[model samples]
Target: MADLITAGRAMSRRHLLAVGGALPLLGACARAGLGGGFPAQTVRVSAPFAMPDIAVPDFRGARPFPITTYGASPDDQARTSAAIRMAIAAAHDAGGGMVVVPQGVWPTGPIHLASNVNLHLERGATLLFSDDPHDYLPAVQTSWEGIECFNYSPLVYAFGCDNVAITGPGALVSKLDGWKPWYARPKPHMDALIALYTMARQGVPVAERQMAVGQNNLRPHFIQFNRCTRVLVEDVTIHGSPFWTLHPLLCRDVVIRRIKVRAHGHNNDGVDPEMSQNVLIEDCEFDQGDDAISVKSGRDMDAWRLATPARNIVVRNCRILNGHQLMAVGSELSGGIENVFVDNCHFIGDGKGADGWAVPIDNLLFVKTNERRGGHVRNIHMTNVTATRLRGSVLAVETDVLYQWRTLLPTYVRRLTPIDGLHVANVRVAEAKSVCTIRGEREQPVRNVSLRNVTVEQLSGPAITTDNVEGFRRDG
Candidate 1:
């Protein structure tokens, strides 16, 4: 609103909204019965779990450091990348600043952010990333699916930094020439994944679990804020990511608002907030190849070792153009996920995209887990969600969602994820295959699930289906 960052001093959340001009044309927050909560000036969540106020990062007294002064040009990728790195370093050294990318088509490689730096892009700017995987060489610590490994660096990466942001009305476009071939899961890729999983299972040091060498085609994330605090990503458009679009891993007090993502690549989820706390994702639009917002903790032995569950996350006022699910909570969650609230979101129907191809969504809220994924999912709530059409059920919970890893490897430890306390209210679906489906395990049945005022106009199957579910209820 206030240009994302004002000139002289840092602005509070209230100040940012107060001085705001006209908001974007994305649909307004859904205000149906028992709904209409948005996250414009604050994170106000009405859920069964306790939610603390998520603090938005304020860059007070931040100076401006333009990359052009450091010899960045629109043409040279090496020089622009170096200039960005230098500008971020200079700004971090100067305590805080806006590392500005002016209006131009700037080609760059990996952008590593530092503390107290707001990588601001002007309205006409486009930071086009190189497709070459080698540009992201010299491996940095990142995650593949859910296991931690030293792989290619994300397009924009930050680690252990506080008060960091990437803002403005610009676009981050990735050239996918290099990543297209690696999307195929060949034998080599499968072998590499097994190796990484074995290493993580054996408690190898994260520094030594490198997968950047050889034919290990573990794709890097587009933007990752790893182990950072007070992070904000706002008002930016992301296109054509290699993997998951925006990932906040083990972070605290993160706010991702007003960002648009149209990444239709393999496994290109919109935002994967894994093992993070106090997160608020609002007013965003996602046209993804995978789930729109997939909330996860960690996976298997790696997650058990970290011992940090994802908690107190809220998503509101977002629009999903196309996705496998409007929202998914973890088949990769071994460290538990709880206190999640999704409110006032809408899903656009099947439609032709900019490329003139039809994209369709599947489910509304899908909670997926497996036998090997030993975690706990509880206190989940969804309200005021309206979808025109869905290929699957409105609410689907599966205890056997291990996609490929099921046949590839045996379960080293037999543990079932316990799911409980799921409530869906004020959901209206125009057409769907079923109203709801819950397939819980016999060992640990899903418990305490309720549906109130949820209606589907045209449904092919039963209104409610359950297997090994306990304490299930339906209300008008």
Candidate 2:
């Protein structure tokens, strides 16, 4: 089951704030070109809000700083973790360059990037990360599930940088063999999470929320580009992830294209763009155990304090091989979300693993919030999409998803959120347990929902379900 936050009195958001490709277009061994190739002329991205054409830098004119030249060996030296840092410095010193990881297996700890650096992996090269949590110590600023904290650093992290990228045709594998021994959530994690919740409400400073200081054991994301600009991640095959595979937080002008992600471990969401805007994701393939794509802003009081709503995101030409949901918004959207457009996508469920066992997907589009969420969501549009199979409704909007918070804590009053202007059109679902479920809170009902040219070929349940929804319409 998908778990959302227990709504507390969260802060309200005022504002918030990126690919490519092809040569046959396998980015596996390719490197050195930037501005994504998929624009209005190529991918035929809709101009509903006039999604801007992404600019990928041309690295041909930049310097090349190969890690191997800086004493990084494919052998044990790669694990030393200092050689790659030197290379990133060399690139930054050159005013921007390609920090090349040549063909070989280079083991390392967390990779902290600088502005104008492109970490390019060559084919047959695998950048394997260690499973030890302490390797990412001396916590940098990162969020765990949405709350701001100084926690574990993401494996590939860029903080407050501009014009950074991770590109190549190689595989960036996380050796979770050590960490997986400790399952997704243990007692320590639960206790730590509860502590975070308490501290968030107490108005504790984020730096003081030192989650990485103790046995908190909160996992870090595989890739995080926080407070960045002009970010690009293309053509890499990211197989094993520590947490969310790719997360861009509080960023702008981001582009992700032609990447392949098959990280099925716990909380292995393919990509999460939180408190970000002007982003584009295209030509990517995902096989995850969680939502393929989740757009979020923030969680709880920390989020309310930020008040930066996520907006102007474009997701297209992506294929979901299997996951919990094709796309989802909130449980964490207290800061709010707007102007989202998803089109020309495919949700082909095939979660069956090596032994041929799997979990089925639930919905194509899921918008969820809880009573404690005081934010608003509007201007959501999904067009020209396809879903092969689903165990639940094709589209669902729920105002209450307290999950663990239902029994863990008590709420004084429902700070119901106002949801409106959901437009889904030209959708085809092969099998759906239910066509749609428009659930709204009694205090603030959902409004202005339009589903047109939608056909559920094999709907086993109700065609439409509504609760406190006004101006709901379905057209042929």
Candidate 3:
């Protein structure tokens, strides 16, 4: 046991050192020139675009101020919040320095970010948020289950900012006080919570939610950037989010790289990009309770008003440790989505514990469309994806019904909506318990769906099954 512990410690140290060394290299690569007929106009932010020999840029150089203040006692809510506010102010006054969260157990309330600011944390640094409901007050604009509504403030939020980044080699932990146990709270409080959710569901504006910020009534997300541009988030470890870990909404030219996002909570997706364009996500690791990566758009009429499809997005060279769904595209796709490409990913499903056997994880890829509010999904490509253990179908596509009832509604609105132009290739599943399932409505059946070079080791049912498909083909 001692030897094993020693080996583990050594491995941890080595991993830390390797990560540290790569930072400089990555910085240098970010500035290097890509010469292979790559479009000069296009901005390449992936690791492959980094220069071969140059050192990574020191992030501190890009900042203007130093983190000289520390949050008060871990439990002192007011003091910690004041300190963080001061640090942000100092950084902003200095015309842009990083607000460094030095190595410590600083407990604080929600920390708001400013423009031209970088939230940097060094190794051994930890920013633990308070679990007290009152620490986070007032509802804010957020999404739940892909529906846009008023929710809690994200732990870190920035709206309509330019040249903002949250980069470091540290951890961002959200201490969600045991909201998981509904029984612990009083019945009246639970009823009120349900009422608030119902109001939001009815499309009541978030502004009407009289709840305090960061309260138990509405859950908070880890990192949220809304309608921002030129955003970069890299080299961070985030865990224990009450909701989605990293969510970018209505943003453009964003890059998320080398991030480790892990959380075990209801709807705690690893990364969700909603109503955003020109996104690049690469070299990230996700172990979450929900979908590893989900693409979504607006919901209902509000989504139509947004009218911006998530386009020109690419996700590559990532790993999914354990998630409800490895990759998913929405049931709330009101704004429509297109031009998505996912490549070179590995999914390692959770193994069965005890019982001397293993149960399967969910599907590797899931795509669905809502029936009531019609939308279009097209030009999606997946290549070189490997799944180790899959309990559900390798791929599942289900169109939403027009109404809540399983039965058809009065109008044609609840009819099956069509999804067009999906392509999957080079997909390999080592072990799967069920055949892939695809369902489309009768009228608007899925159109032009193609699968090539797809193989499954073990399948309990038909390898591929589709209902009401318009033009489906499999190229063995």
Candidate 4:
């Protein structure tokens, strides 16, 4: 089961920020047009609040340390993995440089990236991750479904690294030979999930919350930048994933640009920015099994402790071939989300890729939260978006989305999420089942939603439906 929510009328005065597609920063390969050097770049976007300019690390004049020099052999997983590890170390030790993966089909295990390193894959190169679960052993500090735990490390993992990037015209491919079966929600898997949830609620130390043990079915993410600053992922193609495809957790100043992702595995969200700040995602294409871009601020009490909001995020000029939603704002937002801007994006290819992959999208924007989540959603804007089709509404805001967790456990905290300040303009969709659905709570209704020049053709349901919403307005 998937989760989502929607906006109300008239954006709050406090919610005025960005508009076009401009950002000021040093960027990755595709953004800076850098073949091997980091150059200063700027992009502009229009929104409601003051969007901070992201700062990117400078890798200019940096030396290159190719993995082939460290014993990388084609099709050898162990040798290639060792070579990558060694090359990363060498680059980091040199103060900062590119750890280049030359053109070849290099099979490898889980890769741990270091600080001040650019894991660059040349054209025609691919990192075919191993299918064996043991290859990602000794659980690392990670999160599953918003709750923090010590789980199997992501395929490409970076922790607390500064000025890091994974950029090139190459690909990072996952082998689902072993992970495919873990997608099933078996009894053991459900039990493990519940156990982790309960432990988190009870304030269990994250170290003691080891989930890579026997009978646990929690899948690892494909790529995760954990608690890192000045990050970038650019120009690469990703195929398949064990879980959420790209996750930037608690990171600041992250830029993900000009990449392509086709991951239809369970929970394969294209990009999930959780408890992060000042992020820019532009010029990317996504075909995923779940929400294409899911913005989250962490979950429940575990997130409340950190007190960091996922704020000042911008997504521009992206194309969604297929996804559950173009964007989803939290069923796990207990730490709050604010100042998100989406502009100049579109849905393409009739929900089907050229390779025959398809996933039906439910909405353009989905804002979902339950009474158990006590976060606030504010200053969210989407402008100049076009879509061909949608299976559900164009915009949906639901206050009671629990999915499988409704019966698994009782609400540890019954604070309802406060949602406000949503604005949409110049949106055109060919068709959809409904235009908008706002199912807010009576106690604390959603507020200040405005839609200007939003047009949808062949709508099967009401243009707007509201339950406990305030200040909703639509103007041509």
The predictions' CA RMSDs to the true structure, in order, are 11.8, 8.1, 12.7, 10.1
Error of 1 at 136 (Å): 0.4
Please, what is the whole-model Cα lDDT of each candidate in the order they appear? 0.84, 0.78, 0.66, 0.84
| Model 4 worst lDDT window (10 residues) | 1-10
The TM-score between candidate 4 and the true structure equals 0.91
Error of 2 at 137 (Å): 0.5
Q: Ten residues in a row with the worst lDDT in model 2?
A: 10-19
Per-model TM-score versus the true fold: 0.90, 0.88, 0.79, 0.91
Off by over 4 Å in 3: 1-42, 45-60, 70-77, 182-206, 209-216, 353-360, 401-416
Clashes of each: 0, 19, 20, 34
Residue-by-residue lDDT tens digits, candidate 1, 1-476: 11211210122333335323211100011112111111113445555578887765565456899999898999899999989978887876676789999999999999888767789998999999999998886677789999997788899988777777999899999999889999999987887778778778777677667677668789999999998777899999999999999999999889999999999989989999999999999999999988999999999999999989999999999998878898899988999999999999999845566567545787899999999989899999999999998888878999998888987789999889999999999999999989889999998999999999999999888878999999999897
Clashes of 1: 0
lDDT of 4 by residue, 228-317 (tens): 878989999999999999999999889999999999889999999999999999999998889999999887888998889999999999
Worst-scoring 10-residue span by lDDT in model 1: 22-31
Error of 2 at 218 (Å): 0.4
lDDT score of residue 363 within candidate 4: 93
Decide which is better by TM-score, 1 or 4.
Answer: 4
